[model samples]
Target: MVDIIGHLGMGLIWLAIVSWLAYDGKTALGFVALGAPFSLLPDIDLWLSKAFQTVNHHGVVHTIVFVAAASIVIGAILAKWVVPRFDGDYLVPPAGSSYVYAIGAVFVGGLSHLFADMLSAPDIAPQVEPFWPFVETKIVTVDVFYYNDPVVNWGLFLSGLALAGVIWWQADDDDSAVAA
Candidate 1:
C-alpha cells in the first residue's frame, strides 16, 4: 500500500480540484481537512491485522462495503450540519448534489488509497480485494513501483501542493479584482 503522505496527497488533491471547480480555495481547504483522513481510513486494516491477526492489511476495509457505510454516515453529517452552517455567500451546491459530493469525496478518498496501493508493489501488501464479499478477488495487480518509493510519493505530494497554490493564487486575484 502507499504510505500516509501519498494517500494524503491524493485525497487533498481531489478535494482541491473539486473546491476549485465547485466552490473556492477556502471551502476546498476545509474539505481537505476532512478528506485527508478519509483517504487513510482504509489503512485501518493494518491495525486490525496486527491486533486480531485475522483480517489482513488490504482485506475487508478496502472493499466497497466499508466505503459505502463510512460515506453514508459522514455524508449525512456534512449535509445535516456542516454545509448549512458555513458562512459563505457563494451559492452552496443544491442539497442533493452537495450531499452526493460530500459522500462521494469520502468514498473517493478511500478508493484513492486503494488505487495508490494497486499502482505500486503487489507483493509487499498483497492485492486489495476492492469488490470483496461478492467477487472475492483482487482487482488490481501491477508493478508500477515499490510501495515506499520516495520519488513517486513525494512527486505526488508536490503536485498536490502546486495545485493548491494555484487555487489560492487565483482566489487572491479574484479578491483583488473585486476590491478594485
Candidate 2:
C-alpha cells in the first residue's frame, strides 16, 4: 500500500543487508540491480486486476506463494538467459551459484515489498494476507504511516540509498586492505 518509492526503498534496504551478509562488492551491486525490479512485482496485480476479474490489488498476489513461484520463474530466466549475457564483472554469481543467488535475490525483493505493504496497506488499500491459504486471515497492519506519506516514503528511500552506500564503501575498504 505504500507508494512505489517506499516499496523500492524497502527493497533496497533489505537487499543491501542481504548482500552485505552474503556477497562481496561487485556481486552485491549486481544483486541489487537485478533484484530491485522485483520489488514492484507484486503491484503487477494492479494491472492484472484490470484484465482478470479474480485478481485484485493486495489480494492473493500479495501472498508468499505468489512471491515464491514468481521468484523461481524469474530467477531461472535471469540465471539462464540474462546473467549469461553480462560480463563476469557484472553480477558474477559464485561458481555454480547463479540459480540460488538469483532466486534468493528475487525472493528478498518480493518479501520486502510485501512487508512494506503489510505495514501501511490497510489504511487505504485492502488488507494484505501475506500468508494466504495457510493462514486465512489478514495480518494486522502496523499503521505506522499512510500509503502516500511523503516523509515516510522519502525517508525510507533515502535511508536505503545511504545504507547501500555505506555497505559499498565498507566493501571497497576491505578490498583495498586485502590488496595492500
Candidate 3:
C-alpha cells in the first residue's frame, strides 16, 4: 500500500508512457487527464469497507476483474456523455474507437495503481490478490519500499513529472518540425 502520492505518481508515469506510445500529441494529454482519476479507484475499498463489511482495503476490489468491470461502465459513460462534450481539440476519441480508447485509459490507470500496490503494499497493508477469481493466492510482493517512505513516494512523483515533461517536449519538437 503505497501512499496516495506514490499511487498517483505511478499512474502518471505509466499513463504518460502509454499515451506517448499510443496517441499523438494532440490527444495524449487528454487521455492522461481522463485516466488519472482511475489510478485511485482501487483505494475506494478503503471507504467502501466502512459501509460494507465484505469490502476490505486491498481485498477483492483490488483485483483485475474489478478494474475491468469498472472500466467498462466508465468507458461507456465517457463515450456516450463525456467525449461528445469535448471538441476535436480536446478529448475527442478517434471515430468508431471511442469505447476502446476510453476503456483502455480507465483500465490502464487502475492497473498502474495495482502494480504499485503489488510492489509496496505488503510492507504495511495486507497482501493484494490482483488476479482474484482466477487465482486465489496473493501475488508475491516486492516489498522494497515502505508505505510511507517519503523518498520513494516523492521520487516516483518527480520521475513521473520529468518523464511527462520529456514526452511533451519531444512531441512539441516533432510538431514544430512537421510545421517547418
* Per-residue C-alpha lDDT of model 2 across residues 22-58, encoded as one tens digit per residue: 8887677767777888988999999998899888888
* Prediction RMSDs, each to the true structure: 3.1, 1.8, 1.9
Q: Which regions of candidate 1 deviate over 4 angstroms?
A: 78-98, 178-180
lDDT of each: 0.71, 0.84, 0.82
Residue 155 lDDT in model 3?
88
RMSD of candidate 2 to true structure, Å: 1.8
TM-score, prediction 1 = 0.79
* Number of clashing pairs per prediction, in order: 0, 0, 1
The top-ranked prediction according to TM-score is 2
TM-score of each: 0.79, 0.91, 0.90
Tens-digit lDDT string for candidate 1 (1-180): 767788887776776777666665445554554566788888887788777978777777887888889888988787667766543653233434567766766777777777777777385877877777888766555667777888878877787778777766766676678779
> What is candidate 3's lDDT per residue for 1-180, written digit by digit as tens?
789888888888998999888987646766777788888989999999899998878988899999999999998888778766654533445555778878888998999999999888887689888998898887466777898999989988888778767766765765688789
